[model samples]
Target: MSGIYIHIPFCKQACHYCNFHFSTSLRLKDEMINAICKEITLRKNYLANNILNSIYFGGGTPSLMNADDLSKIFETINKYFQWSPESEITLEANPDDVDNKKLKIFKTYGINRLSIGIQSFFDADLKWMNRAHNSKEALDSIKVAQGEGFSNISIDLIYGSPTTSDDMWKKNIELALESDVPHISSYCLTVEEKTALFHQIQHKKTTAPDLERANIQFDALIKSLTSAGFDHYEISNFAKKHHIAIHNTNYWKGQSYLGIGPSAHSYNGQSRSWNVANNKKYIDSINKEILPIETEFLTPSIRYNEYIMTGLRTMWGVNSDEISVLGDMYRVHFLSNIVKEIDSGLVHICDDQYVLTERGKYFADRIAMNLFFVN
Candidate 1:
């Protein structure tokens, strides 16, 4: 099975911390929609003959698109590929854009899952993030989605914001639990380069996110969710039993997926490519029947590094057997290097997997790097 990720690159407002490729204007919305449809038709064979088990509409805000535009995109997919009836079709929406009218249209066109961007249920946090939605809408959207009979829901939350206190962070989790969404994707607020938040820090207009404070919040998040019967399947993600995000899980498992639209990425078994980040350039290229993408053939070392990086972040951990595929030298290097982590109680071998221990979760990236093959 494979997946498709469609990026809708327009947003009503620019969040202070977001660095994802997106435009704040809708002047080219219609043209962009057509370009996406064309891109889908052009890349139909990217997944070969695999059944599409997941279709995700992500981006600036997929909910921003009208039902007609979304339905047309669905039609294009149905024409080109084999879509599984049980496939998990997720649409990432902001709270402000959700409504009963839109919900019915989503159900009619087959959106079984919703990943709402409810970064916070507080007005101050929402304002700080420059989100288009307000507190009332944030609370209403989930109820509205449930009222419309959309069961599988995932909402995002951000932690460690300059304006968010620990008490507020706890309340945010409480709000999420109250909503009873089956899955959640939360993260420590990051100030990425070229974003408004980054510039604010650079100019000393705002202090940088406190790492120590963020760690405390992360620990609290794990404890809270774990006690509430949610699986900490991956860093920054938690879900109820059997309700994990399949699209993201597939990516971590090294499955092939074709990403469409500006700044989208695609990967097969051995190579990867990304479309141009420029909206107009992407549309122009598609109009000319060209894929404005940059490609790379993965080296064994790069692939090995990626496997270690991703595997260490999940509940599944890194499989030692899979490491042997890279070469006997890599296997030896892993065994030799992992002893220190094991001795330090950061990692342990279980069922042929070199999995991180509880304490190791916080330093997953650092541990993965230490185990990396330099040759």
Candidate 2:
């Protein structure tokens, strides 16, 4: 099944830790939406088959768009894209932008799933991250969405922040569970270059994230979620049975998708393309009838490396038989490389599938890299 992703590169405020392409100013919001719709029409045939199983509205902050703006974008999709009757349409939102009225508009536009960014259920943590929503707003937003009958929901939680302690982290987990959402995506705090958090660390205004505490919090996440009957489907994603995210799971499985708007990336199994991160440049090029994007044809080595990277992080693990598609030589290389890991009890064969053991999940990245093909 195919999927489509449309990036809305606008945010109401800049979070200190975020490095995603977005603008705090709304001066070009309308033009950006128009350009996005045009881009959709231009790249209508990107996916192999015209049938889509999902469409995800992701970005700096998709909820920052007004109801009218979102309506226009969805209208354009209906005008061109042919999706299944059961296609999962997801909108990523921030707590500050959610309310009963807007939630109703989301339903009207045929958005069936909501992924809310409620980083933490604490005002102190929110302020530390420079997020726009408070704890009260976070809780209220989920309630409002549920009240409006939007049940297929996911909420993002951030742990391991400097301001988050074990107690506060537990509270955040409890709060998310209380929201009764089927899915939760939690992540550790990282200081990427060019972010306000990075600057703060360099200037000594804030300390770097503590890896020890982060590891502890991650262990906490696994215990808490699994005990709560949530499947630890991926490194950062957990879901109730049969409620796995269609868009993200498809991406992890190497399925094709089309992405519209600035800074969005699209994959078609053998190649990938990404639009210019600059909004002005993206709009100008689209208006001039030029798609301002760069494309790359992934080599077998590159594709194998990517599959190993994404596959090892999920519950499904990498398919050993599918490795033949990469080439017999590469498949032999992968098998040889993973021998030590499998013997070390970090990875193991289950029936015919390979998956991470609970202990190895903590060091999945290191394990994946060890299996990467270098020529």
Q: Can you give the TM-score per candidate against the true fold? A: 0.98, 0.98
lDDT of 1: 0.92
- Tens-place lDDT per residue, model 2, 1-375, is 799999998898889999999999999999999999999889887878778899999998898777779878878888777776589999999999998888888898889999999999999999999999999999999999999999999999998898999999998998888889999999989889999999999999998889999999999999999999999999999999979999999899999999899999999998999999999999999999899999999999999999999999999998778887989888999889888998999998887577889998998999999999998
In candidate 2, stretches whose alpha carbon ends up further than 4 angstroms from where it belongs are none
Whole-model lDDT per candidate = 0.92, 0.91
User: Model 2: which ten-residue window has the lowest total lDDT?
Assistant: 76-85
